[model samples]
Target: MKIDLFITCLNDALFPRTGVAMTRLLRRLGHEVRFNDAQTCCGQMHFNTGYQKEALGLIRKFVADFRDAEAVVAPSGSCVAFVRDLYPKAAEWAGDEELLREVRLIGERTWELSEFLIKVLGVEDVGASYPHRVTYHPTCHAARLLRVGDAPLRLLRNVRGLHLVELPAGDQCCGFGGTFSVKNPETSTAMLADKVHNVLSTGAEVCTAGDNSCLMHIGGGLARLQSGTGVVHLAEILASVETVNPAAVVEPARFSAEGLA
Candidate 1:
């Protein structure tokens, strides 16, 4: 199956390797993936902050970017969720009839990576290998908005030598609400503290999550105080193998696969 890749703005700037790993994993599963130069932000931040007008411009850009693809795939649940759920609302708020139609049309085409893999491809095993004991953190976007269910676990369970560990209260939000983190640092850190504690208690080497935003926050807090468990994007884990470690796929430790336990 042919699919267009939406390397979200966050992933593009912070964790480009996660995007690359996504492509590698998809291709290894025998899917033809395409990337568009015009692809840009899904404008999740602007919409969430009540900047509906500004977000409308992004909605139009997102639609224009991926509207013609056979299918659209993004390694980000947050961005994909915004595109799928909020774009039309933004359009409506702007009182643009044509924009609403366009937003809805594009939103229908966007899919979070895991959702596209399990729902559209119907395959759990992508024939990837990884030797590690890892826990999966169900990000708010992928869990609640995308409601990807056990698609990630279903796929991770099939990886060779990959031990899936349970993260206590793993489904709880990591408190990284994008702009919410910056605006409410103390609150964000307080919330992230619980998430890190849960991760540490898991005894797993690494915690993998769908949203890079959450992982970034979780990983940063875990690193600042030197928490043992590290954070990694789910796409990285899915794309990882013994020979090609997702750890090496990243660098500089900012978005790097460090503390990926």
Candidate 2:
């Protein structure tokens, strides 16, 4: 199957390695992965920030970008949630029936990375190895919105030499609701502090999540507190192949986009 990679705005700018890792993992599973530089934000920020009218253009662009793909996959759960849950609303608000039809079609084909890996592809183990104690933070969209229950954990459990621990309050928000973090700094910081405390309590060396936005928020707090805990995306862990090259798994910066064609 040919898959289109929708590297969300934050991943493109702040966490390019996540996209690169996702592409590597998809190809490793014997699927052709295609990257369209034309793709941009899924209008999630605009929709969440009450800029629905302004988000219509982006929604249309997103629909147009991956319309022909057999399946559209994204590493970010929140962005995928936006397309699945809000694109139709945006089209309705614009009173564009044609756009609404396109939105429904595109949204049905979009999948969160874990959802696609476990459900669509029917594979729990991607043959990964990460020898470190780690805990997972179920991002809001992945947990509540996307309802990706146990899919990520099942994959993690299959990784060789990886010690997976349950995070306290694993379902709680990491306080990184995109604009929510910016608009309500104090509340966001307070929530983040509680999350950081829980993460530290896990005694895990690394904290992993499906979304970088949550990881960045949780990671910043961990860094400020001088904690030894590091943050990694789930895709990076799954993309690791000891035989192919251990460096790519240990250091995401070593990930090359050469195979992302």
Candidate 3:
């Protein structure tokens, strides 16, 4: 299958390696991955922050960009969730029946990385190996919105030599709800404190999630405290192959808060 890669704005700007990993992983699985240069933000932030008028423009552009794609895949579950769940509403609010039709069609073809790997490819193991004590954090959008239940865990289980530990209170939000964190700093920090405590309790060297935004928030807290734990994306973990040099593949340096920032 020819898959068009929608490198979410966040991933494109901050976590380009995650996009590289996703592209390589898909190519290794024998699928041709294409990137559309004209693609930009999915307007998730604008729509969420009462800038629906501005978001409408981006929504129209998104439909224009990916309407012809055979299939769209993005590594960030949050962005994918916005596309699949909220784009239609944005279109509806515009009262553009034509745009609504196009949005619905595009949304159906859009899939988050884990769901695409499992549901579309029907292959759990992408022959990835990451020998580390890692725990998975289910981001809010991926869990509550997309309901990508156990798909990520299924992929992690098949990874050779990876010790997948259960995260305590794993479903709780990491307190990074896009603008929500900025608008509610104290509350976000309090929630993040709870999340950090849970992640530390697992004794995992790394915390992994499908969304980089959540990872950034969690990683910032961990970094501030000098916590030995590191935050990594699911794509990076899945893209790690035992044959190649680990340093080259993982790109561990960029996973840090300062590095990602």
Candidate 4:
């Protein structure tokens, strides 16, 4: 099966290595992957931040990028959730009927990384091998918006020498609501502190999630408190194999900002 990666704007501009990692994971599993360079923002930031006009163009850009592909996959759940769950609303709000029609069609085909792995790919064990005690923080976008529902957990359970620790309040958000951290730092910090506390309680060396945004938030809290735990994207884990150590797969240096840029 040939898959087209959306490589969301964030990943394209900042974490491009994630796109590389994602493609490699698919190829390692014996599938063809293509990175359609035409892809851009999914209109998520604009739509979520109430910039309807800016979002419309991005919506169309996303549609054109993967309209002909077998499946459109993205590493960030927030972007997929925005394209899948929020695009039509943003399109309709733009009062452009034709655009809204196109948006609806695109929404039907997009999948969050985990969803694509478990549902479209029909396999959990991506032949990935990561030796570490890992726990997952279910991001609000992937967990609530996409309703990913244990797809990630089930996949992690099958890995070799991998101890999957259940994070306390696995359903809780890590308090990284895009611009929420900036608008309300105190509340964000408080919630993130609690999230870090929960992550550390597991004694896992790394805390991971489907959405890099949440892991960034929780990971920062861990780092600030000098908790020694770190954050990693789920795609990195799924893409890991025995020869390729997933735990050592660090996000590129350019993506070191913890999701603010």
Candidate ranking under lDDT, highest first, comes to 3, 2, 1, 4
Model 2 agreement with the true structure over 164-226: per-residue lDDT tens digits? 999999888888788889999999999999999999999998899999899889989998888
Per-residue lDDT, model 4, residue 40, is: 59
Task: Looking at model 2, report the run of 10 residues with the lowest lDDT sum.
Answer: 246-255
Count of clashes, each model: 3, 0, 0, 0
Any idea what lDDT model 3 has? 0.87
Candidate 1 ranges with C-alpha deviation above 4 Å: 243-249, 252-261
**What Cα-based lDDT does every candidate model obtain?**
0.80, 0.87, 0.87, 0.77
Give the C-alpha miss distance for residue 114 in model 1, angstroms. Answer: 0.8
Q: lDDT of model 3 at residue 37?
A: 75
Q: Candidate 2: which stretches are off by over 4 Å? A: 243-261
Compose the digit string of candidate 4's lDDT tens values, residues 1-261: 877777766666656567777877878888777766555567777777778787788788777777777777889888888887778887677787987887788778788888888888789887778888898888888888899999998889887778889999877767779898989889988888888888889999888887777776786687778777777788877777754433343545432222212
lDDT of 1 by residue, 1-261 (tens): 888888888887778777778878888888787777666777788878877678777778777877788899888888888887877778778888998898788777788888888888888887767777788889888888888999889988988888898888888778889888889989888888898888888777778888888888888877787656677788887887754443333553222223121
RMSD of each: 4.2, 2.8, 4.3, 4.1
Residue 90 error for model 2, in Å? 0.9
Leading candidate by TM-score? 2
**Candidate 3 lDDT by residue in tens digits, 1-261:** 999888888887778888888877998899877887778899999999999999998988998999889999998889999998899888888888998888899989999999988888898989998898899999999898998999999999999989999999998899999999999999999999999999999989889999989998999898888888888889988998863332232333322222211
* Model 1 vs truth, CA RMSD: 4.2
Every model's TM-score: 0.92, 0.94, 0.93, 0.91
